[model samples]
Target: MKKTVTALIGLSLLVSCGNKNQAPLFADVALADEKQTSDWLAYGRTHNERRYSPATDINTNNVADLKVDWFIELPNDVGLVSTPLVVNGVMYFTGTMNIIRAVDATNGSLIWEYDPKVVEEVKGKRKIGWAHSRGISFYEGRIFAATWDGRLIAIDAGTGAEIWSVRTYDMERSLYITGAPKAFKGKVLIGNGGTENGPTRGWVTAYEADTGEEAWKFYIVPGNPADGFENAAMEMAAETWTGDWWKHGGGGNAWHGFTYDAELDMLYIGTGNGSPWNQKIRSPGGGDNLFLSCIVALNPDTGEYVWHYQTTPGDTWDYTSNMDIILADLNIEGEERKAILHAPKNGFFYVIDRKTGKLISAEPYVETTWASHIDMKTGRPVEVEGSRYEDGPADITPSPWGAHNWQAMSYNPQTGLVYIPTHHLSTNFSDEGIDLENWQAREFTGGLGVRRKFSDKQPREYSASLQAWDPVKQEVAWYLPQETFWNAGTLTTAGNLVFQGRSDGKFLAYEASTGEILWEFDAGLGISAPPITYTINGRQYISLLVGFGGGFAGLGADAAELGWSYGIHSRRLISFSLEGSAEMAALPPPYFPEPLNDPNFTINDEMAARGAIVYTSCGVCHGSGLIAGGMAPDLRASALVLNKEAFSSIVRDGILAGRGMPGQPEITERELEDLRHYVRQRAMETSTSDRTGSTNNPRKEVESH
Candidate 1:
């Protein structure tokens, strides 16, 4: 139900190999040459997106002494996924809304801030896609970033000032930039989004490192079959899809984080789901959708598809293959070999041979009922009948929220364990292909589907979990479940300690081997960001962005139906070390007040204006017209306006009873009236009186009059 936008951002690094399909404009800078000592430069450490660090200074013995040094709260709810990059004694990281800040790593103090001017409308609008900057890439003292609105920017890392900027994609067409711009071999490799929103074509392009010029673009999904990039690959890929799928635009996008294996010189990219999501609309007969939902090995220089293994072929369940593929060499089948480890949204942990892209062994790390098992024979999934949405509501466990979402995972080579922050949730999806003739022009252009609750909703009932998976054993070695929905990512040290924070405002260090609680502290708000460990002035410091919101809870995507609380929100950055003293004592989580039911509420002008601003909170899922993924009711529709009281009740108490849509705290009647009036005005301005067309059509702008 969410529209796709290119959110690929990059981080600091240099490339060892070049892709063939890449254009000529991207740079080919060499990373790790001169400046390779003790710095956390890029996202996931290297371009391979393996969030693992090689430093062993703070080993398991001293890790228990970790304590809070200092922290600061940001003003936005966008998930703080940034990893701090420390060079010398200063720390460079991103604040909310592409806000880059430099802080003194010795003491959590602000050094400087870089604010890339984002469009005002894109900042405040409901559908403006949570204007966020994940993290930045550093090269030659310059920091590079892909903006929230589709621009590749370079700022002086030392001064936090802009050096150069370029609009990489057409923002007018809704192409947004959320990826951390990766610098490798003089070229900036980046992937685009919009396939989820129904765009027929999506690609990963590289820009010249020094010049920000378009270098190359490798289309993840071929263009329209008939008039698309008419080639053998396109024609072959077309066969994998069904229906008049050209109109739907095959939507396998590379929207999540990706990785690169310098040893192999192959760039690995994880693809997304088909555009309409309904298999019948894609390729009805069903074949391997080539690169869609697959990890494709591409020539970093040419942008050519080398080899791919589709995670979810004929993807009808929105099981995007957009997981971070960590590169590692492990002893598997009694042989130590190079392998790419993937824990995709499909609920499986896959360890594939890196050299050949062949599956070594796969295992289910969660409660999965989709595929019976990964056939060792063909390396394909033997999907169960109930897994596909061919029939009505298929009861798929680990609903596309996934056993693992975008939360980054850390691979500790020492433990040979992948530390993942994962969730267990499910959704019931009823696939209804877009009636192209009846589609509307508004932004909410995805198909219709309802999310349901998975039986194991218990984990989320109290908290999510941090799991340590042993790929060799294909089993969970240890897990520490939290009473929070989201968790900051894991950071492991030579000390045999793993560091992670809970959404309930607690940051703790656990024994990596035993999963035993070793140390803990409260960071004020939930920590949804990944933590980084770096030494400043010979002192090792640990940092994490402490924020509540973003992801399932903040967006309220399928929150209620999925039994997630809606609006327990805040954003901040917290850093720690052994030198600081632990101040606060451990306390029980606060008791949340029951949802209020204030039916007497009504709206006034001033309150309406303020309410309009608050609506940004709802915009992550719902578009500007209050028309989102249909997960949230469209206020402009007849169903909402015709029953204002019912709308108010639903807002206040929630309609999906099991889904945690509790009403807000007591708002004055005047505030309620203002909210009602503002929504009513918005509805009148964008209502569709006659339902004669499909909402997926991009041409029909909604006008109430």
Candidate 2:
């Protein structure tokens, strides 16, 4: 009963939706007012996410004549990691499948695009991965977003219409909603992500903000006390649980970083990992499983539970204190305090103490072998014991795609440091053999029972840096390296600069108090979100959201063996400043598509173990078994699986579901012929190990860690 799709075009947007949130416009004192200049509002633009940017008319000696200044392109080729949101001069954002647009931040134009057609709004449910929706939310004149099929919409920021939505959760109770909606005061917040491929559990609600109702949620984990218990914080998270840990749904899903501190009215959120992440089959006898990888502190008006800080305690390797927390104050010994900082994904870097969650330090920026540290007395994590593979397959180290995931770390209180953007990757975890009453979900949920295995699709060489730390001398004041590992996410300004973006399409801009670089721009495509700055009639620009596809589809086939593909371009939103100029439109000329092999497609081992449980949730957008986390298409050089009726008319008939390949009648036809015999038996074992020069049986890289 909650499907309010609307797309109006401006009658002053129905008089500002009958003046909701009592109009003074964008809430929470214009997002924690850093003397609010030329918008950028919330989502870390301020409220201390410290993405910095008090705007300085393109400083640092004219940032090398900045240039560009206008570009649009977006009709997505599946990747343009969002992060826009400027007010007054317009902006907003979010593309590839969580749709929502509304450009014109002073010269870009395009004012209204909405489409919560969120993949046909997932009407029939049962979906996984291809997740996108990493930005949106504005108060007063509306615009909330959050889709991926769990709803939360609201539209109307100057006429993209709608104005109310609410589905929030319960997609057949497997939960979804790729976070990105965090309004303030009048409420809004959201959170959820399939608990490691099935039988889930996780929470984060809080609706209202002018009538989408609800108003409170906060469940992190601890359910099924015979199906009742939404209070006493799930009765003290059901005493850190024991066996039958709610039979697989014990995952702590607070999906993606949420923040709001308008001066300690709190609401910090962050938690995820553990539904079959193999804590001995989901909490066999473990304890600290309470809030999976904690970081609580709620009470944004009634979702109570006011304090937590876990950070991977008994959470078996999918380590996720859901990244990004920021909120600073520092000064340390000379007194000022207040911190919070984070960096999660279990490769450490905490700093805590935001009014009593304690810990004031945690360390290890990366190169970990899983915990050789982090015991700030009782704050835990000195237990590196086979890193939860318990005496087995443990090649671990900052690699649950975490030595920080969900990139977005920038603090700079005038260079007091923080910058981040890490990546040295690692993974090898093991534990497959599950059956918890047949629990399930999808996409490499470590084939259920946590397997992992990623050191960036093997033939190794990962390393993406940007460091700078010093969160009050917790160290590292430098770093810039990179041979590539999904870049983009970090922007510091007030003119001493520090922008980012590279997966080999440059976009640089360094020197926020030493790291140098100065200026760059290649931007032919691949950029993974995060980069913002605003200013209109008074000048200054610097936008971003280039293109690279979400959570990097597990970097399969190393997205074109490392040029970070996404080829056949198109995914922009660009922008720059100082000498304006604008130009771009020049890509068209790279298209590799040639795999359609079959050297007689037969592949048995029970059809590659039923195509590894039908690609354990569709190899997260192709390439999690021959390793290619992203840039789709590369099934051993695809020729549409050597033409099985155009791969069964694009997976059982939706005919390339309008090009994004959508159509999977929840797959069955003997599970799509055992997922085309496990991707044509790993593309004929990667094309007969490259035509016989085989180096001892290779190929199998992608998914987890």
Candidate 3:
């Protein structure tokens, strides 16, 4: 086996040597193994998804000397949350609308830009997902990017020209791509997210790098049994589910958390939650629900499922395992084992055997009330009484926003610790008056069978933290509390430093071992993306995207309090180095939109009540109560909302589709009027005094069904 692997590697090198311009297949394998560290070649720096750099030029002692090396403003972009990849002196990243840009690594200068033209491609059919792509992928001299409209296109690494394009799914469905495409072994993999939008049976597809031809696809959840299974794995998964789950789509979308192990020759993907989130509606006779919220290992060459470890079995609280799957070697009980460290939404920090998919240890990284603990004997979480909200409404800790979301965490083998960007928010889960037996999924809107409410009265202790946890000991080594519940991801280095950005526009670095603050920089905008470090011309530089907007950023007032109002701050890609000196333009102070109201307009209660339901579709990007959380416009403060003709032009006629406000062409005339009434109602209710402390208030009484 060793000789065969060596011969294959040697042949690949010879082929690459024969053609100097062509990149060899699996050229990033060395970086994945930490043998190459000068460039960041993969989404998580390497295929291990560790997000740790071995470069030590910017160590703890010198990180304080770091200043602005170069910065570029993205004038026409929003939600800049992608990790910029640096390969061979060029930097590549995806911004709003899945627009790919290439720049010089030595100096931030545009080399080329490729716009997917997502708004034009979808033709105003998609209104929810537009500007929230996490990243793009690079492999074999080609850059792979998945568009918001479900098209995966491979571009030439040097010219930014489209090489080939393939549509991953039908456009009529509510599905969208927000996660980065994972490229490995000459194949690029992409997944879509829309668990609560409609009937979505989640799956991940792998395509050939050179061509857009489909290689293989592995469905995260099984389809209808009467239609027969795609393979033996889907048939085996069907037995763990009850009722006609296929009708509801049995969601297990692998939107994130994809890691490839070159040594073991395996692919690992973390599956998402159930379609409706309520087991009573999706799986009447409660079963484990097989693959939902699970980490499944597969044969990458064939997309064949090998083994899986379910994290939140029969997941009822939107506890998705689609967070981060980091592979590391740990010493456990005098034995070295290949382990997968996972801190999923359920609030448990898990260590599982990556090779065999066996549980090693599980502990809560935050306050978790849904499950008391994980039972090692059965490798399942021991649920608390009435925690499922079956008996009544249950207040649970670690809300659906998750203790940890898609924000990447970094695992440093040198420090033997995983630095996690964690939160402590909780939610009140209830199904109070819903007809569970007759429930049906809704299209392009939140169809969650359960209703979740956040309490403004909750203590501030339920905030966020940057925790340095020892994976081997299964305990926190050190932690630093954060002011806001949502922040960016972490990056660790062999220089004993950890870097992270905050929602308050501050990028900071801390001592990896003790969590001591080392350096800080004011980025001038909220950052929801991880930082990456790379070296060119023997000089090291750190780059981060400065803009915040994701699932949590759209969660009404809690996120609005940050004051990263839409169009108020500039989104930028900023880089820093020890020897650099560049002055950044001072940004305007944080501005909060004052709700505009008209004394002459009379309130229509009936229309407003109906509009609240239609607002769910808009709330995914705009805030829940018409508040703007830096992602989109706050309709309550917009003059356009008061004018019927102007509003119709922007919303119904797709006039502003080019600006990221996708027009809802399917909405009727009456529905549009109702929406206007609802926005006006919210504006009238929020006076000057109410705006001070109302951002964290509970959502309006209208259920998000």
Best-performing candidate as measured by lDDT: 3
Query: Which candidate, 1 or 2, would have the higher TM-score against the true structure?
Result: 1
When summed lDDT is taken over every stretch of 10 residues in candidate 2, the lowest stretch is 1-10
Candidates in order have lDDT scores of 0.61, 0.71, 0.84
lDDT per residue, candidate 1, 1-705, as tens digits?
110011211222221124221111212233332123345666775555656555555656777676667655453334466676665555677755576776656654565666675644243222234444556776665677776667788776555657778876664454555666667766677766655443445567888777888877777666666575644556667666656666556677666666767778888888887765666556667777666888888787867667888888877767887777888889877899899999988888999988888999898887677887899889998888867756655667666667787778888777889998887655555544435334422232443222333332332443257899999999999987654565667777666778887665678888778888888776655556778877655666677876544444333222222222222333555667668653433223432212222334343567668767656445544433344322233344334533657756655544432222334334445555566666655655434342222211111111110
For model 2, residues 516-592, the per-residue Cα lDDT tens digits are: 89889887666788888888788888888777766654445555443344445666677788858766666553343
Give the CA lDDT, 0 to 100, for residue 643 in model 3: 90
Which of 1 and 3 is the better model by lDDT? 3
Residue-level lDDT of model 3, residues 60-85, one tens digit each, is 88889999888877777788888888
| Candidate 2 Cα outliers beyond 4 Å, as residue runs | 1-31, 38-42, 48-67, 70-194, 197-219, 222-243, 246-249, 270-304, 307-531, 551-573, 576-579, 589-592, 598-614, 623-633, 636-677, 681-705
Task: Report the alpha-carbon TM-score of model 3 versus the true structure.
Answer: 0.95
**Model 3: residues >4 Å from true position, as ranges?**
1-28, 455-460, 692-703
lDDT of 3: 0.84
Task: Flag the better candidate by lDDT, 1 or 2.
Answer: 2
Better of 1 and 3 by TM-score: 3
